[model samples]
Target: MSEQRVASPRTFPTAGEAAFREKVRGLRRWGRWGEDDQRGAVNLVTPEKVREAAGLVRLGLPVSLSRAFPVAPAANNPNPAEHYLRRRVRGEHGEGSVTDYAGVNCHGKATTHLDALCHVWNHDGMWNGRDAAEVVTGDGVTFGGIEQFADGITTRGVLLDVPAFRGASFVEWERQVTGEELDAVARAAGVEVRPGDALVIHSGREAWDRAHPRPWGAPDPDGVYRLPGLHASCLDYFHDSDCGVVVWDMMDAVPNEYGVPHCTHAAIFALGLPLLDNALIEPLAQVCRRESRTDFMLTVAPLPIAGGTGSPVNPIAIL
Candidate 1:
């Protein structure tokens, strides 16, 4: 047997690209907000939506939807975070305090981060069709920067717990979730993932990682990177539901059948939706199950890093 060739992260096969572009064309929101808009679908998060979401906090409980900062290397974290400590030590009586500096390369599988509209792009361009070469400058992004979300993304959030919905402990790497499964999860949970809301999908990626204890995102002996996550078809559901952000434990399944790159991540530009990736949702899942409800007030404030492609984020789900 021979090692399989992986698709270039930036390119797709002829037929695959054609199929993907066509699928995305129908869901595109190029001019829905305005020709000059940079905020994308988050524009749907009106004041009224925030207030309504706030009203759902009956228990006054908040669950963190973020994974702990990856400070040490692990099977999934190859480039661990950078942390430096400075001690003000005249501390004979422990009077002095300690300060630390931290830096992260947060866009990969390990870090819990928020991907801005400019994080990804291709021949179709970025959010609102701005050319990547033009917007993504040498120093920083000129358009659709993470700073555009300075006020934060606060809206109603509902979890679609696939493990609970499918009666499984975790999803298999070979499996891919479709739009129909999402809809079914919503129905089963008795929740409505309305427009301008955060749609959290708990795919049990963290749990799977713990159970398997292997280096995910790294190619296996067969040279294929495989993971369990949503398929491109889920984009149709997103468009139809008009979701503002997609909060997920897992992202696009690796070695996607699409034969295209950024299988589901294309939504960042295609539908102008932000993606909250690598969220740790098992705790949130446990709470939702215990409470018998899934809807909550989801809030996340990205670091005000102007022109950044994305930001390491800690989102909270208030129930």
Candidate 2:
């Protein structure tokens, strides 16, 4: 399939990553919050911040940014979600009430979920630079579990619509969403990625998946997962902005130009940034465009699962 490549205002990251690597070297914020900081950037979402986010709701409209759960098994979803229903039968009414249960394995290509700080690891260690073993026990993670967000995450949500900015249907492999592109999109949208903002980068993943159906996380001829994802170069932008959380429709382009594994995911380790993965962003983009604004009051409440690594979430973008 030949995609009419479009021009970008920024440089593509595929050239070389000497600068990207240097950014990674200086991106660790292990003790930035504190020695035992369970909530990394969430601390940025202070009560005052939440109140400020609430003020953004001029339209009183909400857009869901989550994908339906228990996705069927496909090339991308190896572990299909489990769902079943049951009813209490009554002679006259046939049923008193209906109940359904859903089991979701949220940490992968298929589910829209929040990634806990303990989700990823690097040579420097987990969030706050703790040892992986110290964080994860036999049963579940002892530190930085999904439950940390039980109080909920309410902040200003900013959308950086890459496809719209580039006048393309979706992000292409040749022009990955790089850090410079992020800056460009934010500037184009006339929004600043202030601290504690739920920065969402819409790479048109839903449209791209619909247009080019393939295996999830499938590697290419280069033996690397090629998806429309944020390039590794974005680490500098993320670190510099000190955004509260990093949310994306396309997570990371693996074995990126820098040859780092899940390089963009380094935000989990380096910046202590919570990552909201597999978000259904097409609707959000539409709402933003319709409303003529990209900022909204974003709220995400994680299921209170004790010791769980992460939880399936239905993130809400209230406009």
lDDT of 1 by residue, 193-240 (tens): 789989999988767777775754555565556667888889999999
Per-candidate TM equals: 0.93, 0.89
**Local accuracy by lDDT, each model:** 0.84, 0.80
Candidate 2 wrong stretches, greater than 4 Å? 1-22, 91-95, 219-224
The prediction achieving the highest TM-score against the true structure is 1
Clashing pairs in 2: 30-128, 76-216
Error of 1 at 272 (Å): 0.8
Lowest summed lDDT across 10 adjacent residues in model 1 is found at 1-10
